[model samples]
Target: MILAFVLLFTASGLQASKAASCLSQQQIREAIDKKQIKHLAAIKAAVRKVVRGDVVRADVCNGNSGLVYELTILSRTGTVTRAIVDARTGSVLSKGF
Candidate 1:
């Protein structure tokens, strides 16, 4: 049980580290203008395939997995969900609150 707790804490730390390196809004806009990342609409559509909610915010991030779009979504009942999708392929990597 202690080992499991340590593992979970370590995993969370790694995820935080990746998120800490995400691009700023200005950089994201530049990437969009240069067509370096997939359109936000496409990224949303991809997340919708596996999750249900309305997107609140989306941003380009360099996650440990790859270049991704991190989105915050609000459900009908007000539950919030966060999703990460591959910026290039629009493939969802993870989704949860």
Candidate 2:
């Protein structure tokens, strides 16, 4: 039983670390600047229009090759909205309504 508990705790820790590895603060900030995202409020507003309802969570997707700002926003309606914006041009590469 003790061994099983240890294994479970270890697995949880690994999972948390794996999620953290997806994105860093510096990368998200850099992506924002590169894309010329001047205001978080504007981004949120636009996202809310498509997502509908409050944003429950937001995260940046890293290691996108040449793409930048892979924004994942979870809406209060339990919808997961994804948008990929150009890092240098502030253009929306792809978005799903």
- Per-candidate TM equals 0.70, 0.42
Best by lDDT: 1
| Each prediction's whole-model lDDT (CA) | 0.85, 0.59
The candidate that wins on TM-score is 1
Candidate 2 least-lDDT 10 residues: 54-63
Model 1 scores a C-alpha lDDT of 0.85
Off by more than 4 A, model 2: 1-21, 36-39, 63-97
The local lDDT score (0 to 100) that residue 80 gets in candidate 2 is 75
Model 2: per-residue lDDT, tens digit, 4-76?
Answer: 9999999999869757754576766775677634335555655555455554444544435553455666667
